[model samples]
Target: MFGGSRRVRQAALFDGASLPRKHISLGGWCGPALMLGKLGLRTEAYPFDFSRVTLDGLMHFIQNGFAEGFYPPGPPPYRPECVGPWVLFRGQHTAFAHFDLNDPRVQAHFQVKMHRFDAVLDAPERPVTFFRTVTARHPQEELALALDLEEAVARRNRSLDFRIVFMVHDQGLRASAVQLAPLSPRVSLWALRYRGLPSDTLFDRTHTAYHAVMLHSVAEENWSAVKVGVVPPPPATMASAEGWDFERNVLVCDGAARTEDVPFADLTITRFPWRSHDNLALIDGVASVGGTCTGIGSTKMLANASAALHVQRLARLKCRYCGDATYHAAGRPFRTDRPFTDEEDQLVLIHLYKILTGGDKVAAVEKLAHEMRRGTYEVICRIQYLTNSSTKLMDSFDPNSLSDP
Candidate 1:
């Protein structure tokens, strides 16, 4: 999506004040023709096109060629010097890379940078009134003291050494403060370690020796995992139709309706157990899955039934054959002008029978519907009703019945 070819044309202008007499040379023609050839264009057409090209047109073409090469590949790699406030140093091999700026080992390390900010009190602004009240009780030695009473333990012994231990008890409390003030609590401290001093000394007699001091802080910004590539799910198939078998507790469409064998990157399956008696389906247990079956065009009863039962639920419940519409439960139909036909009634009856019998005839009907391209219920109902009517008509004229009358 990022890289593609482009073409541009530019015009040349000469000012009388700058150049008293100037003839614009066709220098632009040479650059474009050479570039086009390098980009896989044929050199033979160069002369024919070049002669007709204007200086402006030639300049535009060159600019277009440069634009095509501007967008390269993925983003440039991270440079440590260019890194900002916080650097996300992920474990490369097993060893943790040093954050020392001078360390070459850290130079090649892959890290993500982030920014942070903090505030300090303006100590110089305090007036003599506030300073006197705060400093009046403290001696000059106490005021200049760098170590607290606990830190003075170093003065009693020389062999004793102190260690700074840092533990990240929790990673959740690292939020930036809204404002800075003298009374504002220090959220966390920088632990310091040193050797003991002499009993009479004001400072530690032993020089401080430094070791690794873990700096624990949280990013001031949100971070998200960078997605590389994703493999999608396989396309739907007949096996997926097992999901639609509610009696088996597999209430999904098993994808038996797909005609093509091509695989898809992703597929979604849903269950519709309550769709069996859905009013939208002229024949129950069948409802269009995606959209209405109207545009499917002059299909047989089997196609319509399959679409309703297997493919999707109807967007609207208009008869596929006659366009006689039905309401969605309590909703009004577009028009109630047309009455239900005998064919529709028969289809409905057969579907009702199947429901009543706990789908006893479903397997046989499904097979027939698929094979004949005529819906099983509709065809069977028409035949049964016609035969019964004929039998009744014949019985009315029976010799025994006539004698009794």
Candidate 2:
């Protein structure tokens, strides 16, 4: 949400690159690749590009194509671990899938159809004029129902009003699609990982993908609270303190030596996820095909959320420095005419507590000050310093800074 600058373009491209971090900054290969030749990034280019994409559904097609090919009905040709570095952008819907097994002899059933998953992902409320979800259940039937689609097609032929989406799951690529489309481009699959099983020797096929999504299931923990038009506040702990030496980073960013721009090769490494406390293992001992750490089985994956944590920290630090510089260079207009009232002082501390803690639930700083053995007066003094320095710093830059404060 920035004006006509690099920041604006960065925000626009987050969908193509990864999830929304606290903020987006120009770095690695992205900065020069997108910006320089065009005399750096522009805000106008982004919105224009977005509107065009939405109007034509170009990006949707690209992502849809990626997901479709990511998992094949049959075995994969190459080692899944050798594959990858697939970019993950946030989806409009949480994305889901559902399939049911029922007796084939029972003719009564409802069929779900989706012409394109991208359309649903783009607009969940877009009227179901065409593609919608359908899963037929045949209790007496087996998964092998996939093999007998000819009978299923005949049964559908007998019905006067047969919506194409409802059909036997075992139908071959063309048989299932013949009624609705040559091929139903829509696929409700997300969060795919490699399955341990290899391809059958008789027929070479794609590796079976164990996907987190199905036909019509939303990921609850990540997407249930669909509060329309709500903007999430920035993350308090910019980056987990585990990686960068916070204190040192600040000293360096505010005063580090020999700073050269880092490249994006390992910018590849930056987006990996961490081990959640879950106990598990890989599908077939093939954790990840790509060089990056997005493992398949028991291997822990790095969430895109963490990628920008540190980046924001660093950017925010530099941003504060730049803001202060810009302010001074412009002659300290940020020097508010009047001092903060007592109530305002408390409010400022309260805001700080809210921001620097566990997502507004707990005031980590208030407790941290105590744990650090700072007496009541020191805490007050620290708060005053923080308030004075940071008031102008709000909306100044991205988060995660260089080193320790």
User: Whose TM-score is greatest here?
Assistant: 2
Residue by residue across 207-265, what tens digits does model 1's lDDT show? 11111111111111101221112222211332443222324422232133221222222
Q: Name the runs in model 1 displaced over 4 angstroms.
A: 1-359, 385-405
Model 2 lowest lDDT segment of ten: 79-88
Alpha-carbon error at 347 in model 2, in Å?
Answer: 59
- Report the C-alpha lDDT of model 2 over 161-235, residue by residue, as the tens digit: 211111111111211111211122221111112212222210011111101111112122223332322322212
Model 2 Cα displacement at 337 (Å)?
A: 80
Q: Estimate each model's TM-score.
A: 0.14, 0.16
Cα shift from native, residue 343, model 2 (Å): 66
Model 2 spans with C-alpha error above 4 angstroms: 1-118, 121-235, 238-243, 250-282, 286-405
